[model samples]
Target: MSLTTEQITWLTKEQISWFTKKQTQTFTKEQISVFTKEQIQALIPQQITYFMETQIPYFNEKQIPWFTTEQIQALTIQQIQTFTKEQIHWLIYLQIQALTPTQISVFTSKQVLAIAEEQIPYFNKKQIKAFTPTQILTFTTKQISAFIEQQIKEFTPTQITYFNEKQIQTFTKTQIQALTKEQIKEFTPTQITYFNEKQIPWFTTEQIQALTIQQIQTFTKEQIHWLIYLQIQALTPTQISVFTSKQVLAIAEEQIPYFNKKQIKAFTPTQILTFTTKQISAFIEQQIKEFTPTQITYFNEKQIQTFTKTQIQALTKEQIKEFTPTQITYFNEKQIPWFTDWQIPYFNEKQIQAFTPTQIESFTEEQIKNSPQLLLRKEEIKSFNSKEINKYNLNNETLSSEIKNNSRKL
Candidate 1:
């Protein structure tokens, strides 16, 4: 016989155990809805497990969120699917944590959006993996904030791509650092733009190296402006090599001092030519010493013309000695006059040959006298005073030796 409403209400736990599953199923939703809250709480897991999914709405709304893990675990997939958005929002952390991955996967996108912030941190990786792309994007900023580094890192790149800008901006520095290189590479340009200043440094060299040029170009002006020297230093030469001139210029000037010789040298000629006077001077002396002659060639004559004597003379004696004749010819006299007396001796005959006669005349008498005789015209030779000619005459061993000895000290 079908269960009557009054009889169903009177059945004690012990008496309910005697009912067949089919007899229990026969209880109408109207009869079940009238049960006291205490009666619903008292139901055994096995009894709760056997309730027709159609009867789920009959359970007290207040009882839904309070279900113990054992009662929750007994819930059929059909019953789990019936969870209201309000029910999903009210599930306490421990209760949410207890939902099987399969049960979590059954949640609709609307239900996923209703998940409470405090409960987000408790989802297992298996449940996280089960989330749909649409469901993942529904996570609120507050929900994302509670995510542990490990929990956030396990999300697939594709799943991560679905995050809204507001959600992405909430990533903690540790969570940003926890991203794998490949996963980091998958960030959309819009998502990448939201990386706050504090989180920018959290990217490792490997993660920085994986960024696509298009993704990097979308970084906000302010975001690019705050990259500390150490962060810029972490970029791969190949990564840094792709920087556009405007993009390169956006790097903070204080950070400019940290560029290593190789990094400075890696800049394209067009990139170098774009430097403002201040930017040009921002290069550390070590970087200047490191500049390849080819890199120096990219500088306009005004830049070359304006270089302080100390800047030119600060180059290593070997680097000065090795300058291509063409590169030496590019230096203006104003720059040339500043060359140290020590640098005078390092210029090879070929480099000296490239100098203009005006340049030839600008050198100290001693420099002209010591130079390769082949480089000087007879007119130029006669231009030197008798004392300079005496020093030039190497066959006059005593005077030449005396000049050479003094040159070593100079």
Candidate 2:
């Protein structure tokens, strides 16, 4: 016997299931539209599967909220594909978990995006792994933003690569922090560009180490600007050694005051030489004080010449004391002029005397005129020519004059 829509809606759950199983495929769209949300929610899993695929899309959006998670879990792929964005958006977290990978695979992009924020993690990474890269790419900015750390790590590199540059830009710092080294290694230059300064510092040390020379070279100056002292401190010597001169110079001058002692110690002198004159000149006095003197031998004369006179004078006596004779030899005559009179007494006879006579000869007339006399003994003074001694502006007569006068007196 045929029942009216009103009567059918009033039927008990058992009767409704029996009637649906027998006639569901034959039901007209108008008849199906009249089924109450309660009747749909009460259907047994087996009976829920009996609805015609064509009719499933007819269910009003409100009907999905009442369907038990178990009923939704029993949906076939064809039935799942029939859901409209409106219906899918209403699925609760429990029902979201109920969507099998087969069902998940059929969701249209809008339907997938409509998945609620709270329900995002229900993809149960296994489901995520099964998603084709194209399907994963459909994730909206908010949808991608909703991913938890573990879920983010499950994204395959190919899936991650499918992210349009704009979608990639939306990753939260927490999600960025979750990135595996292997995953980070696959980040494209375009994707790398979207990272904000605060986001980069969250990288684990291993993640930083895994950055390719290509990727590190791509960092925008602004990204480099926010890498704080501690964040910079986390990098290994090897990791830090990869920065291009431009990249290193892009770093905030103020951020790297410990450069020579800590960050720069890892750099070969050739690498250290890449710093711009301004960058080298920006060294705070504390940085100059703590700088390793042994590293000085690596400086080419040109690099050594960049240190301002003030910086030269700021060098502590102890720091200067570490300068090997080899280190002293690297200084050109022009660089020697930056030292002050106060610094003159600290150079012991060996370090000062290490300069070849030719380098001393290249000294400017002013350098010779003001040069210290006591740093060497009387014999050292005797080695100087009468002209060189005269350049010292000493009170005594010329050495040649002294010799002749003393002979005559004898």
Candidate 3:
């Protein structure tokens, strides 16, 4: 009774086991002697199946017999299909050593789709890479979509470089659009370059708009500023605007008391005119009544030029009249000659006549030249010839006149 191919194909575990037991008991030395290794190899499937049924226990047990690479390769499609996952894993382990391209293609796709997810990592490199186009296409849209999304951040440079443009473009618009701003942000510089080279538009305006505050903060300053500039109202105008009205007002208010001559010069004429009379009055009152010596020194150095001559004159006269004698002594000792000059114009003829020569001698020539009060009292100091007075004259005169006078003196 010779077995037909179909009968051999359909041989059950019971039939295979019974035959193996009977052969072991009944086959004589002379009968085995007639078979060469090739002849025995042809007969071995029956023996192999018999041992698999009788010797191997349940599939998941660790005690299962290891199949030779050649033996696994010889299994029929039906045998391969019927394998439990553990049995399949065993077969895959053996097959990886010697599988042909077609067999690898067939088995990798089947295992990837059918193997327990936990077993996925056990797949060999060649097996993983051998997945066919058809096998890749068979994945559920979500599964394939997730691979693309994860790859944007997780892929190594070599992996990104290896993906073909068509495979990259296979990601649907919705899939690409689904990435969060955070996910987009995690993309490596290499991945970003790859995306650009492939011309894949991974980020959409809605995705940009969806960025969290922390994500927004993570943007490079240039990137953030450019985005804000392009979308002007995208950020709060008070903090983001180049010329924020609030910031300007705050700086102006804070800086006013300390504004120096150089700083006053830096202000436009418009800024000069913008301060209210009340602010000027407040500053003058604060300086005369409350400012410390350190503050007065700062004001003399930094704030004097911020005032017009008329404003200075008014502030000085107000200070002299309102300040205590001790405060006036302190102010004079600070060498703020401007105050003394301003007070001169307000002196009556009787006040000038009342001044001692020492009091008149204390005045600088700039005080005499620029202050109407000082000019009116100048005759009282007519004999003044101090170096301090002359220096003031040199400084107040025209540059050419000072240069000519200095040359003549030399």
Best by TM-score: 1
Q: How close is candidate 2 to the true structure, as a TM-score?
A: 0.73
Residue ranges of candidate 3 with Cα displaced over 4 Å: 1-65, 76-78, 82-86, 89-92, 95-98, 108-111, 137-410
Residue lDDT tens for model 2, 166-262: 5777888889888888888888877787777657777776677677777777888888786766667666666567777667778676866735456
Better of 2 and 3 by lDDT: 2
Candidate 1 C-alpha lDDT tens digits along 261-314: 668778888777776666666676777888775676677655666566657776
**Candidate number of the best lDDT:** 1
Tell me model 3's lDDT, rounded to 2 decimals: 0.42
Error of 1 at 26 (Å): 5.7
lDDT of each: 0.71, 0.70, 0.42
List ranges where model 1 is wrong by over 4 Å.
Answer: 1-10, 17-54, 74-77, 204-206, 209-222, 268-270, 321-330, 356-410
Ranking by TM-score: 1, 2, 3
How much does candidate 1 score in TM-score?
0.76
